[model samples]
Target: MNITEVRVKLTEAKKNRLQAFCSITIDNDFVVRDLKIIEGYKGAFVAMPSRKLADKCPKCNSKNHLRSRFCNDCGAKLNDKRALGESGDESKGKFKLYADTAHPINSKCRDEIEQKVLAAYKEESEKAKQPGYKPPAMEVPDLDFDEDNTNS
Candidate 1:
């Protein structure tokens, strides 16, 4: 899929590892948002949007985060180890805390995404250096809000 557009929001913090947040449009058809531009140990890299992994509480059957010590609803101690694996060993819970919402299937696709995202991030970073430059707002417009105070 061709990366048609990429918009980046550079982070204000200098020492932060999270450099920027980006949204990419693919072929003008599909749009993926919340992709992160992180400053890694080696260099900057693109991280796909991900959601925190959750496990169901055995007592109340309530969904709780993987790292949650106790269930939010029931207050029962979470069995994270069991969720990680069949084995009861707590030390063996090496499961990932988050899962990607959208990701490339192959290395080639990943490389292409990385290249485009990083390039856009670099461009945005340079733009930030310009005097009186402001990052573009990523928020959606409120459709329900009236321009004039109708209720008043």
Candidate 2:
């Protein structure tokens, strides 16, 4: 799939590791939004759109975020064991509370998307240094919003 366009929105805080957020249009038809550009220990990298992880509360069967001490709905104490490492490796860090919503299937595709997004992010970051530069609208346009005259 060919990437047609990439839009980047640089983050304001200079001290944070998060550098920017981006959206990409694929083949001028498919659009994906909310990709993050982070400054990791190695360098800037693109992270696919992801959502926070959650689990069902045993007491209420309500969805509560991972690492929660108590169920949001029932307020019952959660099992601490459930908060263990995501990969089940004892040596690994804390349980991941987030997972990627969309990601490339292979390293090749991942590299392509990451390269394109990071390039756009760099260009946008430079523009941000200009005196009158204003950030672009990061919000994805609502496709379902009716633009034509209505209530006729």
Candidate 3:
């Protein structure tokens, strides 16, 4: 009823999130079927058989494979030392989120970018509407006047 371990292939890939299938082995030595892979925040995560957080390292903040402890490069411990208290369930371990920079899918960045783009688009749309369109909405404006004009 949990994921014991996971294995993955390191591929020289391009931008966006890493998407792939994973095999989950239960405590009884029985394996779960292939799970669908969508763009994951980090790399791949196998959440069955036992409990594991894939590709999340707490030390140097570099994400790595689930089975890997200590950064593959910096040697910072992948699992946080504090996670030992989590009822022996590694999945419940504290995993500082590390977004994959080398490559990312459109999912994460899409909303942020879309929001900005939508805001810009909305601004432009409003600007375009200013030429002719009018809506029944209250407008709050701060006013300033020249002293010379007031002197009259």
Per-prediction TM-score to the true structure, in the order listed: 0.82, 0.83, 0.22
Error of model 2, residue 47, in angstroms: 0.5
Segments in model 1 whose C-alpha atoms lie over 4 Å from true places: 80-84, 87-94, 140-152
Candidate 3 structure quality by residue, lDDT tens digits, 92-123: 74443222222214556434332333343344
Of candidate 2, the 10-residue stretch with the lowest lDDT total is 143-152
Q: What is the lDDT of residue 135 in candidate 2?
A: 96
On residues 70-143, what C-alpha lDDT tens digit does candidate 1 reach at each position?
Answer: 99998998765655666656587345667788989899999999999999999998989999998999852222
Superposed on all Cα atoms, the candidates' RMSDs to the truth, in angstroms, are 10.5, 10.1, 23.9
Best by lDDT: 1
Query: Judged by lDDT relative to the true structure, which candidate is superior, 1 or 3?
Result: 1
Of the two candidates 1 and 3, the one with more favorable TM-score, higher being better, is 1
Query: Which residue pairs show backbone clashes in model 1?
Result: none
Candidate 2 lDDT by residue in tens digits, 1-152: 89999999887767766677789999999989988777776788887777767899988899987767899998999976675755556467445666777879998999899889988988898898899999998773222211111111
Name the runs in model 2 displaced over 4 angstroms: 85-90, 140-152
Ordered from best to worst lDDT, the candidate numbers read 1, 2, 3
